[model samples]
Target: MTDLNKLSLAEARDALRDGDVTSVELTEACLKAIDAADVLNAFVHKTPEIALERAKAADERIKAGDAPAMCGLPIGIKDLFCTKGVPSQAASKILDGFKPEYESTVSQQLADAGAVMLGKLNMDEFAMGSSNETSVYGNVVNPWRRGNDDAQLTPGGSSGGSASAVAADLCLAATGTDTGGSIRQPAAFTGITGIKPTYGRCSRWGIVAFASSLDQAGPMTKNVRDAAIMLEAMCGHDPKDSTSAELAVPNFEAMLTGDIKGKKIGIPKEYRMDGMPAEIEKLWADGAEMLRDAGAEIVDISLPHTKYALPAYYVIAPAEASSNLARYDGVRYGRRAQLAQGDGITEMYEKTRAEGFGHEVQRRVMVGTYVLSAGFYDAYYNRARKVRTLIKKDFEDVFAAGVDAILTPATPSAAFGLGEMTEADPVQMYLNDVFTVTVNLAGLPGISVPAGLDGQGLPLGLQLIGRPWEEGDLLNTAYALENAAGFVAKPGKWW
Candidate 1:
């Protein structure tokens, strides 16, 4: 049973195929693991009834010789994705009692692939904060760390719960959406592998809108192979989402060569910020050395627009967030507040939203409103868009200059104390995304793979980024580094 938790999705599928284990047995094992790890707050909802039923169906199909690629695998769904019968709150009080009539396209696709639905995982309210503390259900503890004291650790957000669950083996692999580093950051913090594909590769049809132009759904898993399998199943075109690309979906799993020979990896000079921890720096350097040993050339390159990326991302993401969040006015969806004397529906909406949103959420809404307001639109939003263009242009130039991909540190440092940045000024939290936000702005693919552990016994992640629609190359490079680093640390077993 314990070995089931350590098996990759492919291995589990083979075990089921070979009749060494049944879907029912695997699901029960995961359920037991979840029950034992409930203190971590990794799950917001556990649909055991639904999960078992699906597992039974999968087992029957496998017995009938109709097994699919991901048949019978239990997977975690992030709370942000709308589930048909589950409350999809995005972990915010404003969304209390809200349920969608439709299942998100990616979720539907996963179901079509025969993956069992474990439950919805926790996340920061409305995907607003870097740490999970902003979740109304409370923070998700790092499963790699023990104890209940919130200050001892943090699960990176807004996809922190998904990361935590996957890291702790609560689920095989999970779905994650990235607007500005949400998936990649948390995956880095939790010492797991997550990929943010090129924008438009995955459908965002029923995903809760954050920054519409930037929101993308991707996979979070224990290794590149499982991630590749999930990504292949999750990606497709949806006519409902106008931005969903009409390109051909590749066989991601079949393409894993584990060979990235002769690839030109560009080390972006500007990403090495001054305050970056020495451990993170060494991880990046070591990653370069690993690639060099794999017969890939490492070239030092510059992304001059990087200095302006975080500022531009903050302005644009918030501006879009402010506009998208207007739907939660209490009349159509989400919670409604009681009116005070002389207050009507307008006042009710104002109070409900004000009381429902967390600090970081409210801050972004205010910034969004201010930037999109009549007097500031041109000065703030427009300028930010122009800078975004420049950042994209920077990547195009580098890729054109014989760079197959770029390599850098996934996060500035390893996971910090849970409360370390919660009470901090917003800018400090914003800066934590410095190394990652630019890739989203450019509509490119990026991934985080565990590189090594830091001096503090925390995990450090090395990031590999690819040009648009080049997830094949991105995953190949990551697999190469994964082999070289050979760093896999499991959370302490308490069961």
Candidate 2:
């Protein structure tokens, strides 16, 4: 029999329904795989009992012929989502031992759809860093490595564990939040499929906040169809979250006809950055050609404000983060530092924060506080907001001109070794999000599909940004790319 854990989410769902497989058998296989793959550090918090219980229930639902698309599928829940009675630290030391009584809206919806939870995946501390190295649980390693080297590589950031788990077959799929490319970037690095729905598409309630305006929860799956199915289950109008979209959800998987005929795909000129790795440029062009061959009309477009997106995002995300994270003081439910002699409330706050937040989180908090401070708010924070508006306008103008979607490279390069870019200059590290942050700024739906591999044989992905609220169309284009590329490379088992 095929390795039960190796089946994609969609395949597993069908097999469960057809009696070729049972949810319990699949869930147990995943549980056992997670146990053996601990060296990857993908599953930060394992919940075997809950997983098996949920699987048993899902099996009963399937037997009764009352199962949703996600029913009986085992998946990893990112630590960012609050699962009732489960640890959800968001990979931050301050939130250690922080378990919420309520489950996140997205997770609750998935549970209602009959998906089994295997465990919580790790992420960057407060979803700050571009690489997974900022995680309090330590970096989530990429299953793919350079040609013959065994050196550990990052699974990208914030949603790193989600990408790693899906790519490594630790889970059929996983829940991930994309705040400035968290989901897409990691998915690219891991050679999988991920889509960040328009900001506000997924309810933010019960998930730990990062930059409130930019954080969007989406699926990281082995294929685009699975991403669509899981995303449908994860999104809806939530009265609890003011940002959740009110429109009725569509059948995203059904929209995957793999036909982009007559679609006008725009190729933004600005994204051809100076010193971008040649392979990325070639991969972007190759993707455009594939789309064109699939009957998509490739048109040259300009997004002039894109150059400012990274700078603007660094300012806006951190500024909001500084505000959102203010709730994590010592008086909260999370860890409180040991009190010293004469330590009052003020001392407790300082000590707890200093001991809790990692270096990257602290650095951003300082930068955010500085930008929002009285003396510099206008010079920095306010100016960045203005830039963000222009960036959004760039996409709007292009989409208004009959362009169905915009195509670009997901990341400038494939996965890099852990600690390769972190120690020296931080700016070098921040560049990883250059291709991805613009989508967040525009609140546009974007997807990254593995198109080719880089020189090191690591996977490279092409991104397609769709019009706001038109994710179904965007996903259809991605399906075309996926079919055209025929990218089926998987990381050789080494862990």
Which candidate ranks first by lDDT, i.e. highest? 2
Candidate 2 lDDT tens digits, 39-80? 899999999999999999999999998999999999999999
TM-score for each candidate, following the candidate numbering: 0.97, 0.99
Stretches of model 2 off by over 4 angstroms after superposition? none
Q: Write the per-residue lDDT of candidate 1 for residues 1-495, one digit (tens) a residue.
A: 455866779889899999999888888888878888888899988888889999999999999999878889999999999999889999999989888999999999999888998899999988888888899999898866533333457878889999999999988989998888899999988889999999999999989999998888999999998898899899988998999999998888777887888899999889878877778888889999999999899999988989999889999999999999988887888888877799987788789888889888998999999999999999999999999999999999999988998999999977877788756587888777888899899999999998888776677788899989989878988888999999888766543
Name the regions of candidate 1 deviating beyond 4 angstroms.
146-151
Query: Relative to the unseen true structure, what is the C-alpha lDDT of residue 211 in candidate 2, on a scale of 0 to 100?
Result: 94
Task: Give each prediction's root-mean-square deviation over alpha carbons.
Answer: 1.7, 0.7
